[model samples]
Target: MNHDTSSEQYILVTGSGQVLAVSDTAQSLIPHISPLLPDLINGAGEDTVLLNGRTYQIHRHLLKSESGESYGLLISLQQTSAVQSSDPRLGAIALALSDKLEINHVLENVVRFAMDLLNADAGALPIYDPDTDRLLPGHLVNLPVDLIVPVIGQRRGLMWQIVHQGSSILIADYADHPAALPELVQVGVRSLLATPIIYGKTPLGILAMYRLRNEPFSESDRELLQAIARQTAIALQNARLYQRAIRNADERFALYQASIEIGATLDLEQLYQVIYRATTRLVSHQRFVIAIPTENRMVEYVHIVTPTGRQAPQQVPLHCGLAGYVLRFGVSLRLSGAQALPEPAVQLLPEIEGELADGSLLAAPLIVGDRIIGALLVWSNHHDAYTMADLNALELLAATVAVALHNAFRFAQIQSQAITDNLTGLANRRHFLQVLHQEMERNRRYHTPVSIAMIDVDHFKQINDTFGHIAGDYVLREIARRCRQQLRDVDVLARYGGEEFGLILPETTYEQALKATERLRTVLATTPIMIDGRQINPTISIGVASFHPTVYPDPSSLIADADRALYLAKQQGRNRVCGVQELTNDAQP
Candidate 1:
């Protein structure tokens, strides 16, 4: 059979496949349509088929007598691609889209090209978002301001029908379609054509065209629009991949910078700030918070960013709240839309007021191996605010911060061990002398008075010998606790050696030192510590000394005066407070 590229071919055949008539254009294509006549007559009104090397659209028109009984069929065949290939706008659209790598640019070109190709009054290409289950307006042409719907679900209207069914829809008259947008009908939109944009097995979105005149869209128009939409899907896929690559590169750089700064930081506050900054690079938010668990099983809100005067949560039960949930399970939590917020988060964060109940939240645990150290959270007021990609970015930031926090904790443990007494959890002897020397140097420059006291546990050896070393350790611990409770925050209490403790009282005179020291002596002796169901009454003798610029030459002299006072107190009685001022001049520093 020969083909005619000049015009559409027409063939008239009976219902039983007998030829009745043929157009001059169809004379050359008799053999092509003869065998397919029976199938073509029964097929839906319009279809496309490949003949030889050209794609042809076959339109079936039923011929009936006056009684409406079908007798013959008039079939029309037109080459689709070959005819449209001659249109210069098709070439221009192809060339314009060849270099577009951005999603917005690709969408803009696709819509404008569709409008130009169909000579429609306006157009729009709404991109499909699977996360939100909606088609969001991507690009529009010649539409009035405030007319486009903010969002359209995938189950309503012509555009959504095509989205759900993966097919094309042509509404020849706006008033004829029951589900047509009333505003569009009122604005004199005569027709609407929508087709799903698909790439292989994936559906990207819809390509919709609008016409203002009474002229309806033909099958050729639907075929052309569907073809362009499928091609646009490929470009859309490329643009998304490019965007993800660029975003990933940026996140990597932020993590690298944060690692360098955090590794050099030993201060927890400074490290928190670095983590916050690094997180901002990955996740945008209206509020940011960092929470860590306390010894009492509570989540302490260590850092928070919120509006002024809003009572941010400082502490809450660790087994409650969203932050606790993240840390306890060591998993990431992402909540989108206020309507979908979990009831438990709302109930736990009741004090957070309206903010927590009406926002999207994302929380990732600061975990090292199987241990959860804390949690990082971000919040936004908008519904559907975060996606899986956003959550993944947060998880990456959490991983980086987790390592830094672990190292910081290890460093603090080491530093504490070096200066702390393991037996009593007080300052050790070396740290005590170091503090005494520092105070003396500072007082010497300012001419301020500083005082010191040396305390000894009376009859400690007898108690230890009778009760065993474990009981002795318990008594020492109890003594340190009582001394710490009675001392001022400015004073430094330390285990000096064996059974002696040193206390530094800054700016205290002889009188103040004696009163404070005597109180400590009374508190320890009055409260009998019960250990393992046995009452053990313990007593301490305190020596109070003050810094006099002319009398005490250095830290050692001050310490010596305090020790002499202690020896005098022990000799006079077991439970008493003695002052250096009361000592003989020969015995004083």
Candidate 2:
């Protein structure tokens, strides 16, 4: 066969690795290729050979004599200035990619590099949506308007075709192409090229370049674009993986914080606050509501926190609204734009009329075991503001909230039971003493007066003898209820023992306590305890003692003084009130 060795460099080598012939340009590269002769002979197609710090593209061909008998191997060399220019930018991009840990930053850098490398009028890097099988525009440069690529039944656009076929595509007459977008044509795009950004066999996205001039992309341009796409795919994939790792770490930290902060307190209000603070870190919202289910299959808004303040909680029937939907179905709902919500859901949530006008809603069910306890609802004032990632985060946060709320409720119930009297539904003796001690300490610090009252039924034994013990129990309950009515909300009332009661009135003077006890004495005397159609009038003797730093230094001393006054009240007359000083003088020898 004939050969052209003048314009291009060529080398002929015998099978034994002896140089039989050489072109003028080949002589300079012979030294570099000789040391790697075995590798050059074994390697097929084009291989890069570096000679004296310069890169050369080498191609190998088999030389033959007549009758197809192989005589030797032929090699050619071409200098790589095009590749050299791209090397620096590619290296810079690699450095940029390695420096960035954020996915968005990496994507922006890729789009900028691609645009500058191609010198196109505009460019875009659209990420592949695996679920939709379409490209969602990620980063764009100098685009007049937003571009929305479409995916038809069997005819995805040129972009999808390039990804589907795993090849680079160049459309010189893009305006006339079948898969060209109308927007692309209107924007004066005459030529375009799209290269699939791929990681192994999986396609990540596409890097597309657009030119307003009617010029066809050459084979070299396609190759360069493919090279850029490959680099971008690796960088993008690395950034995505890194970001995913970071998100996972953040989520784990948030859950750990939730476990510690939410579980730190048994108070329901404090638990709600902790959940609010923790969830705000994951997602931003203006309104947060926790809806708990009632025994009657109804859902009640147990907690509602808003930017302004808290709102009064209200209840609705099951399956009535969005929150009800989550509670009834035990699933999550993320709705963006008012149009996304059904007519029935809108009508059910009339209270949130202002928020629904132009807001996005994310709701998730709070489930513990098989029981669906409540639902978490968060609302934002922007349309389509929440993503699937945000919904997933809310679900995770809802889990932590559910466990904490359940524990807090149980703790509250246990606390209530511990300090309450079973019969009269009043504070027990232990609770009274605890409160008295605390109140005395507080009074000492603030230099405020605290009063205590000791009361006994005037004729409790006679009432039990006359009526049955059941009636006596009824009388005691009635008396406790009346006493509670006369005391302030801050006052502490306890069932001291059988037929007796104790009261700790904080911020009260001696005279105020006496007058309050007198009112209780009169009320009990006037009110009759009715049992089985029998009216039995009951009265109570009362004693009052006010805190004096010198005289009543502690809770026990105050109680003792009040007891002395109570004996005086019994001695003087039943259904009366007496102070500690009055009792001391009356007992003077």
Candidate 3:
């Protein structure tokens, strides 16, 4: 155990157990064999120890040779203080070593240093998985490599306790501590130390060590682990941030792909599926929903995905649940745990009882400019598992999703708008023409009778001249409503033009079309237009024409036949239904 300082390898040391050593030719030391000097008498080579923080092997040597003739000395020595750095720049360089060094090399050095400091059998640094809330054993020395466990959120094990409480857990004997969960004893752990790796306020789980010897974990041992955990926190946090950024970039690329697919997808089901899959993958959630707000604080779930991964039917009172809270407040709620939630949230958890109580939740308010158009709810099974970084990433995704869905709904609205009469809330002239074309085609294809009716308000221009245009508009809207009320759901009613309205009737003969038109005229005559608290009666003239495939050749023939009947209605009287008879041979003149 005689020490050898003849080689200029050992450099400097501190009272705080920090050592600095150097070798110009190589980066590390390897153990070698030599003699122990006992012949020099006087306790030579008794209790000297050599330690290195990096990968190194210790060697025992002698002070003298030739039959052990000289010394019996065992001088306890380590690196001395003169060569150590007192400059702040040296400290900064030391700090940046972890960034420059490969993680494998850093972890190897850390494990070796930890073992030397604690005199422990083994140690392992577990890298954290934020997605699964688990720790995977890594960078191990003299330990089993496969040990992994959940360390955050809902897992009630020792590692989770250390991480969630943000403190270290030291146990002299795992068998004796009542605080230790049952799983801890089953691992054959005699004594264990679990300390959190914290970088500022963020926790990166724990650096844990186990001893089979039942030796008590000491204050010095805890300090050594604490120092290592601090460094580990810095390294792990850096790695995590780098990984998260990479993941975000990948998610953005996927989002772009999804956007292109969704834009081209006319199938609503496929579009929603793409949305849900992308949402759950990017935001770390299992369930999602789209709820649209309606009148009187009531919100309807336009789309809902159950926790079991099935899509529910639409038009349910979705916002009456947790979704309603977001709509009423117009803000996001990230609930870590439901039992610790507010009263309004508690009130909203009936239908989603087990799901809400056991899951983490993030709701993003869908705002189209200044208005709260809807909301997106993302749910996970672990509480408080998401960070501000994850939330910010998801916020971008929510914007994309909201804009896409809003665009889809708007597209549907535009399709319907193309044919709608805005002022009267009826079908416009173009819609009337389209319907006539479709009806004529259907009749020709099926050889069935189709009816057409043309109705004009009686002296509508005179009425507009008598009353103001506003009153005329009000009268027109009233006539549209009465016409709509008198028709069946399958019937088509539209404002044909300025003073004209038209209807296309499927499976109706000429006689039946005339009867339906007369009823529409009667209804308009009885319906009073209330403008400025004054009531005015309105009348309408009607014309009816019907043809089967055997009679009219095309849509043009149907419109011409209907126009002739309309002329006859004007010839007979203003407010009556008139049907056209076929032109006789004598009437050819």
Q: Which prediction has the highest lDDT against the true structure? A: 1
Off by over 4 Å in 1: 1-86, 116-122, 141-159, 172-178, 181-191, 211-220, 290-317, 337-347, 350-356, 436-453, 465-468, 485-491, 504-526, 534-541, 544-554, 562-589
lDDT of 1 by residue, 332-403 (tens): 878865556554554356444226545678889998888899899988877667788889888887888888
Ranking by lDDT: 1, 2, 3
Q: lDDT by residue for model 3 over 276-379, one digit each (tens)?
A: 77776667766668777876656766667766656554443544577777767777766766675645533564444236666677777877777777877777
Clashing pairs in 2: none
TM-score of 3: 0.57
Residue 71 deviation, candidate 1, in Å? 68
Query: Is 1 or 3 the stronger prediction by lDDT?
Result: 1
Q: Pairing residues by index, what is the TM-score of model 2?
A: 0.63
CA shift of 27, model 1, Å: 48
Clashes of 1: 0
Per-model TM-score, in order, reads: 0.71, 0.63, 0.57
Candidate lDDT scores, in order, read 0.78, 0.77, 0.64
Task: Identify the superior model by TM-score, candidate 1 or candidate 3.
Answer: 1
Specify the highest-TM-score model's number: 1
